[model samples]
Target: MLRRIVTFVIAVLILGALAWALWPRPLAVETVAIGKRDITVTVEEEGKARIREVYTVSSPIAGQTLRIDRHAGDAVAKGEAVVSIRPVAPGLLDARLRRAAEAAAASARAGVDLAAADVKQAEAQLTYLRTELSRAERLASQGTISESALDKARLAVDTGAANLDSTKASLSVRERELERAEAALIETAVSDSTCCTDLKSPVSGRILRVLAESEQVVQAGTPLLTIGNPADIEVAADILSHDVTEIRPGSAAVIGNWGGPPLAARVRRIEPSAITKTSALGIEEQRVPVILELASPPPQGLGDGFRVVVSITVWQGHDVLAVPVAALFRQGDAWSVYRNVNGVAKRQDVTLGRRNNDDAEVLSGLTEGDSVVLHPSDDIQDGTSIASTSGAQ
Candidate 1:
């Protein structure tokens, strides 16, 4: 029985050794070597090209504006007549109004007649007063009348002359009132001139739009057209509030997707406030307008409201030691990655610095030339054995 038991135990040991050697093991894993590279972090989003300044022309007075002689995209010069406005015609009077106007005109004529009669009476009285004054002076010199009486006569003559002048001025006022009342009786009429008032462009630019296309009566301050210079253009981007905090005026940027070569640009302005916008995923976000100016002249065919893509540089580094972002995994409160150590995987907790979509800045727990396994699986552990799959640095 002892000999049989020893023989069976030796056979069992051989079978166990064979099974361990032939068992399949997971050792092949893709990894990348850590190295120094130049990295630039940017916030990219869709944007549009637009004119820097837009000018709106409005009517200066209430009148009938003539039909616009210019079309959109037409060039215009300063002090050029862009719009012509004629005086608005007077409205037609109804039968009742016509009678009232006639009555008023008759009353004004009667007033003028009465004033003219008063003037004639005053003139005659002034003539009589002058003759009396001459008689008084002669009597005073000949000693036929008292000097005090002659002085009173002379004062009456002076007062009569002043009354005559006042009467003539009253007649003139009544005559103007009659003329105004008669004008109201006319069936249709226009303000003073047959000529039109030409509204000129204040600045030289192309016509962007014609708000008023046909002849129409417009009030003062009504917008007639829009003008802007196409050559003076800029890019506008509505960026997320969180992303815009890192972008300041004068930051470098690149504009693309404009149907031409990418253009270099720089941030010129960031709006002071943010507005609520609904995203494509139905999420509400705060968006801020960021204006970027082209570093060079805009490419041909790039005009206002053209769609483009803007990549604004936020942070950049030279000679940065970075680890593949795919290799990073969350471990409780810290980040962890599996570094390759002589075909063995050793897990290490890492403290990271600035990170992007593809790589992260290494701040601790790593060294240059170290290789880390990418997309580590659940089977990977603190001391998992692994072999290089394909990728290098």
Candidate 2:
């Protein structure tokens, strides 16, 4: 009887050990509790800092500009002489340029002669048409010609007069062209210092850039240097057109990644126009310019065309329930999350509002203080046992 009892006890102990070994355990997961906080949705884009009013100095006449003595960041007062240009002397002018000028003058003179000939021809035609009209009127009164013939003659005279006026206008235009061409032949005095024309800054600012650093012959309107007030700066960002709709003029903005503390700014305007640009992936994107004025003075060393990142707030809320974006996953057609419920993983479908790079706003199906899995894996299912979590097995 004692041997039989021992065998039964040992068999029961073995059965219990096997059962314990085979029983399923909980899956370990990272979990986070839903929290309420202030949330803001923003659109970020690369931007540049630029001066509001930049003045470009250019050669007023075709001449040789002296080597630029000024460098970037050189301060210049308004009316200060920035550079000088020596007007090209008539004898020193390029042979081709002189020849071109002579050719242009000759062409203008020929055009004037042609226009005068046209005017004289029109006058002669008018005289002939008037004579014809008088004869037709007499013949019509004498019943030798129909009134239609007289009317035709009258129309011819009217048309001839109009042609004469048009020819006169053309002649006037040709005359003006000849005058302009002759004026171009007038020699500028090159015997004295007066020949060197000093160009002055039109605004009070520092030289922002020196476009032409060395002495060179430049045509009229060739840029020499750029001037602007460095302190008066603004930021320009090109945002996707579809995303710009949420950005309004006067919207609050933050300027970052500019090698200094983030600067506060306000959107001065959103350009009405949008430019089409190709993204790095070769996707066509419609980008619009957004100008933001610095709410405070920009930090030192920030200047024109310096790169920065801008974040424009489009939406904001107070005391909003939010969750980590990684916690949510696609379940059927809606978003779902594994909510930790009393040591069990419960599948809960959630409604999401605005989302950014890190977090998502929960609109429904979840409340504050609820625990949810951070990165729920495939092994986790509804009612699955979970461990290493606050509300887990």
Candidate 3:
């Protein structure tokens, strides 16, 4: 009787061990506590720095451009000669043309001589008018002539002076015509010689590019170099058209990933036009450019066309309840998070206000110091047992 009783107790103990082994256990997960802090919503995009004002130096007249000694990034001062160009000499004229030029020059010279004679005649008349006016004044003072006669003499002198002044102007015009005629007659001798016309720099800045470097004959208004002040640099970023509505002038921004610490900046303008661009994924996107002005001087090594990453703060709040984005998921039309209630995962519907890439602002349905499961899997459900593990907030 004692052996049978002991055998039954052993069987019961074995069954209890098997039942415990087969029992379901709690799922291990990562959890973080909700907290209050500042949260900022931003839009990040790639940008490039460029000079605010770029000036292109072009040839003023059609001529040969000399070799440029200054290269890209060379500093230049205002009015400093950057390029020297010599005008091409005129082609040699035929005999008939030469004779005609000579004849035109002779006629111009004759005109000059005729003008000189007229000037002399006018000078003589002016002298005579002055003498007559002086005599008339003296006679009138002495009462030797009537007042009407004195007035007549003064009028005559004034008329003569006017005529003399007109003749002098005609003489000057004739002389200028003669000089032009002489210039036309003097043919420019063409030779393998260098006559440089120095073109001065329009503004003080660094050379951005050299369009024409070698000795070449370029037409009038041909671009020679590009210049701009690197210190006056601004960042240009293209943002998707749909995302641009939230951005406004004077919006705060931060520039980073430019090989140094992030720099502070602000939005200065938003372009009115939109540009269609093919993205890397082969999708067409409409983008608008936003201009950013740096709040401080850029660090060393930052120059025009330098690549940078820009983050524009569209919304921000201080001392706001927030949680990691991983803790939240879409539950039908509402957002939901798994809260840790006494080691049990509890589904809680949450109202979200603003969110960024990392964190989301909790408007309601969450409180500070509340532990919540991060990246909860499908196994986690209401009243499901859960064990906390190390994870990022």
Q: Please name the candidate that would achieve the greatest lDDT relative to the true structure.
A: 1
User: What are the per-residue Cα lDDT tens digits for candidate 1 across 224-315?
Assistant: 99889888999999999999999989999999999999899999999999989899999999999999999998877898889999999999
lDDT of 2 by residue, 1-393 (tens): 999999999999999999999999888888888888778889999999999999999999988898999999899999999999988765544778778878889999999999999999999999999999999988999999998899999999999999999999999999999999877777666654655799999999899899999998899999999999999999999999999999999899999998889999999998999999999999999999999999988788798899999999999977889888888899899999998888799999999999887788899999889999988889998999988454321
- Can you write out model 3's per-residue Cα lDDT over 182-268, one digit (the tens) per residue? 787676765667677889888999999999999999888999999999899899999999889999999999999988889999999
> 1 or 3: which has the higher lDDT?
1
Ranking by TM-score: 1, 3, 2
lDDT of 3 at 104: 85
Give the C-alpha miss distance for residue 90 in model 1, angstroms: 3.7
Off by over 4 Å in 2: 1-22, 91-194, 390-393
Off by over 4 Å in 1: 1-24, 56-89, 114-172, 187-206, 210-225, 281-286, 376-387, 390-393
Q: Assess the local accuracy of residue 60 in candidate 3 as a C-alpha lDDT between 0 and 100.
A: 88
TM-score of each: 0.74, 0.72, 0.73
